[model samples]
Target: MSSVAARLAAWWHSGSRWPAVLLDAALIAVAGADLWFNRMPGNWWDDAVLVAGVLALAARRRFPLAVFIATLPMPLLMGQSAASLIALFTVACSTRNRWLLSACALVYAALTIAPWWGGSDILSESAWPVWGVYSLAPAGAAVLLGQLVQTKAELSRRLEEISEVREHEQALATQKVLAQERAHLAREMHDVVSHQVSLIAVRAGALQVSTEEAASKEAADTIRTLAARTLDELRYMVSVLRAGGGAGNGLAPQPTLDQLGELVDNAGMGAELEKGPLPELSPPVQRAIYRTVQEALTNARKHAPGAAVGVQLTQDDGAVLAEVVNTAPKRPAVPLPSAKHGLIGLKQRAELLGGAFEAGPTNTGGWRVALRVPLKSMS
Candidate 1:
C-alpha cells in the first residue's frame, strides 16, 4: 500500500502540470453531472459551492494547507464533493504538518455527519449513522493513503543517501589499501634490491682495480657506475613511496634532457644518438623519457648483444618524442635474468601524463621502442 501510494504521489508531483489540470477538470465534470442528474429543487447555491471547491483543488499542491481550509466549507454547502476529499489527501501527502492534517481530518468527519444534523430527508433518522459511515469511509481512506505515500517517499530518499555514502566510503578504503601496498613494495625493493646492487658495485670496483687487461677494467668500471646509479634511483623511489607521493630529501634529483648523452655513452653498447632541439619538460616527464631509453638499451644488451643501436630524441609541434632501435644480434645473446616490468612501467608512466608508447619489431628485423609525450600536459 505504501509503495503504491508513493508511486501515485511521485506521478502527481512530476513536473508536468497537465495531470493536475486534468484531475481538476474531471472533478469539475463530476460535480456538474451530480448537479444536473440529481438536481435538488431547493439549495441552488450548491452549484456555485461545488464549482468553487473543485477549482480550488488546482492549487492544492502549492498551497495544500490553505486549499484544505478553503475547501472545508464545501461539504456543508454541497453535501460532499470529490474535490474536498482530494484537497485533504494532498495536504496530508505533501507536508509533515501532523497538526494541520489532524485538523483537516476532524473537519472532514464533521462535514460527513453534517447532513444528518441538518435534518436532510436523504436518509431516515434511524439510518443516518450508517449513511455517515458510508460518507466518511472514502475520506478516511484518502488520508491514510496520503500518509503512507509520504512515509514511503521519505524512506526512499534516506536509503538513496545512505547508498551514496557507503559507495564513497568503499572507494576511499580501496584507495588506502592501494597506497599501503605501494609503500610496502617500495620498502622491500629498497631493503633487498638496493643492498644487492650496492654489493655488485663494490665487487665491480674491486675488479676494476685488480684486472690487468684494459678491456676488463673498462667493463668493471662500467658495471660499477651503472650499479651506483641504480641504487640512487631506488632510493628516490623508496622516498617517494614513503612520503605518499611528495618531494622528499632522500629523493635524488632526477635526470633531465642534459643527461641523455652520458646515459647512452655509459650503456657500453655501440649506439648512435640522434639529436634535435628538445622542449623544456617537467622533472617527471624527463624521468620517464630517460627510463624509456635506459630500458631499451638494457633490452638490447641482454637480448641482442653486439646489435647496432640508435637512440633519438626530438621535439616537434608541442610534443617530445623518443625512439630507440636495435638491429638483430651479431652474436649469441647472454641469457640475462629479467623481471620484464621495464617496458610495462615505461608505458604506464607515459600514459599517466596523457602520452603514448609503442614497442615492437621493425620491418628490418630490428626491435624499436618509441614514446610520444605531450609537453603541455607534462608541464
Candidate 2:
C-alpha cells in the first residue's frame, strides 16, 4: 500500500496532472455506480455532498488540511466516500506537522464511527461494540502507509545529496595529491640537479680562466654560461612548485621582460629579441613568459645546435604574446637526453592562466613555439 502511494505521489510530482485527474474521475464514477446498482435511496443532498468531496480532492496536495476538512461532512451524509480516504491519505503524506496529522486522523475516525453510533440500520447492534476499532483501522493504515512513503522519499533525496558531495570531495582529494607530487618533483630538481649543474659551472669557469687554447676556453665559457642559466630556470621552477612559499635565502627575484636581452646573449647562439611596450603583468604571467623563452632556447641548444633563434614578446588587446622560432641547425644536432615535458609544462601553464599555447614544425623546416596569456590581474 505504501509503495502504491509512493508511485502515485511520484506521478503527481512529475507534472502530469491528467493521470491523477483521471483516477479521481474513475473513483467518483465507481462511487456513483455503486449507489445506482445497490438501489440506495439517493437524495440530491447526498449526491451534492459526494460530488463536492470528490472535487475537493483535486487540490489535496496543495491544501491538504483544507481539502480534508471540506470532505468531513460528506461521510455523515453519504456513508464513506473514496474521495475522503484519498484526501486523508494525501494530508498524512504531505504534512510533517504532527499535531495537524493527529487532529486530522481523529476527525476522520470520529466521522467513520458516527453513522454506527447514531443507530443506523447498516449493521447489527452486536457490531456496535467494535465500531471505534473498525472506524479507526483504515484511517490508521492510511496514515502509516503515507508516513512510510514520505520517509522513503526523504531518504532517497538525502542519499543523492550525499553521493554528489562525496564525488566533489574525491575530485578535490585527487587535485591535492597531484599538487603534492609536483612539489616533490620540484624539490628533487633543486636539491640534486641544480647542485651538480652549479658544480660543473664552477669547474668550467676555473678551466675557462686557466686554459690557453682558444677552442677549449670557448667550450668552457659556453658550459659555464649554460649552467648558470639552467640554475636560474631551476629556481623559477621551484618557486612555481612552492606556490607562494618563500624561495629561501640568496635566491634572486624571478626573471621578467627586462631580462630578455641577457637571456638571448647567454644562449651563445645568435638569437634576436623583438618587442614593443610591454603591458604591466602579474608575477605568474611574467614568470610564464620568461620560462617559455628559456625552455625554447634550451630545446634549440639541445636538438639544433648553432640554430639562429628569435624570441619575440608583445602585448595586444588584453593579452601578452610570446613566440620563439629557431632556424634549422647550422651544425650537426647533438643527441641529448630529453624528459620531453617542457612543452607540456608550458601548455599547462598557459591554459591555467586562461590562455593558449601551440608548438609545431614551421613551414621552413624549423620549429616554432608560441604562447598567448591573458593579462588580467590575479586577485
Candidate 3:
C-alpha cells in the first residue's frame, strides 16, 4: 500500500493530476446522489448546507480536519451524513493524533443521534438506546477502514526501503569479490612470475660479463635490459592490483607517444620511425596509438623475422593516424606459439574511442596495421 501510494504521489508530482481529479469527481457524485434523495422539499437552508458539505469534500485531502468539521453540519442539520462520513475517513487517514480522532468521531456520532435524542417521546422512548448504538457503528467503521489503509501503506514503504538497501549491499559484495581476485592475481605475478624474470636478468648479466664473443655479449645485454624493464612494469602492476586501483598508487605515467621513440630503438627487430608534427592528443588516444605500433612491431618480430618495420604517425583532417607496415620476411620465419589476441585487443580499443583499426596483408606480401580515430585535442 505504501509503495502504491508513493508511486501515485510520484505520478502526481510528475504532472498527472487526473487520478485525484477523477476521485474527487466520484466522491462528489456519490454524495450528491444521496443528497438528491434525502433532500427535504421547501427546506432551502437544509439543502444548501448539504450542497456546501458535498462540494467541500474536494479539499478533504489537504484540509482533513477543517473539511471534517465543515461536514458535521450536513449530518446534524439536514440528516445528510454521506459527505461527513467521507470526511471522517479522510481525517483518519491523514491525522495521526489518536485523541483528536476519537474526539472528532464522538462529535460526529453525537450529532447523528441528536435528531433521535431530540425527537418526540424524548426520554420515554426505549428505541433511543438502539439508535445511539447504531450511530456509533458508522463513525467507528470509517475510522477503522482508514487506519487499515494507513497501515498497509506504511508497510509497503518500509519494504521498498529494505529492497534498496539490499541492492546496495549486493553491489558492495560483488566489488569485494573482484578485489579479492585481483589481489590473488597480483600475488601470483609477484611471487612466481617476477621471481623467474629476476633470475633471467641475473643470468644474462653474468653471461654478458663472462662472454668473449661480441654478438653473445650484445644478446646478453639486450636480454638483461628487457628483463629489468619488464620487472619494473610488473612491480607497478602488482602495486596497482593490491591497492584496488592505480589512481592513488603513486604509479609511473602510462606509455604514450613520447615513449614511442625509445620503443622503436629497443624493438630488437629493424624498425624505422616517420612521425610528423602533430597536435597534442588526449591520453587515451595517445595510449592507443602507441600500443597499436608496439603490437604491430611485436607481430613483425615474431612472424616475419628479419622484416623491416616502418611506423608512421600523422594527423589528417582533425584525425590522428598511426600505421605500422612491415616488408616481407627476408628469411625463413621461426615457429612460435601465438594466440593473436593482441590484434583483437587493439581493434576493441580503437572502437571504444569511436575509431577504426585495420590490419591485413599489403600487396607486397607484407603485413600492415593502421588506426584512424577522430577526436578533439586540448589546446
Best by lDDT: 3
Q: What is the lDDT of candidate 3?
A: 0.81
lDDT for residue 325 in candidate 1, whole number 0-100: 97
Question: Is candidate 1 or 2 superior in TM-score?
Answer: 2
TM-score of each: 0.51, 0.54, 0.58
Candidate 2 stretches with Cα past 4 Å from truth are 1-46, 120-128, 239-379
Candidates sorted by lDDT, descending order? 3, 1, 2
The total number of steric clashes, by the backbone 3 Å criterion, in model 1 comes to: 0
lDDT of each: 0.76, 0.75, 0.81
CA lDDT, candidate 3, residue 112: 77
Candidate 1: misplaced stretches above 4 Å?
1-46, 115-135, 205-217, 235-379
Worst 10 residues of 3 by lDDT: 243-252
lDDT of 1 by residue, 1-379 (tens): 9999999889887868788688777866775575455434456576666566667776777898787777776666656656677778887798777787767776787775675574656456677667767777777787888999889977765564456445534544564566667788898998899989999999999999999999999999999999999999999888677544212332466677789899899876799899888756787788888879987987786677668999999986679989999999875554434545567767878888789999999898789999999877876
Best by TM-score: 3
Error (Å) of candidate 3 at residue 137 is 0.8
Whichever of 1 and 3 has more lDDT, that candidate is 3
Candidate 2 residue-wise lDDT, 215-300, digit = tens: 99999999999999999999988876765322232145877777878988887677899987876678778778887988788777
Better of 1 and 2 by lDDT: 1
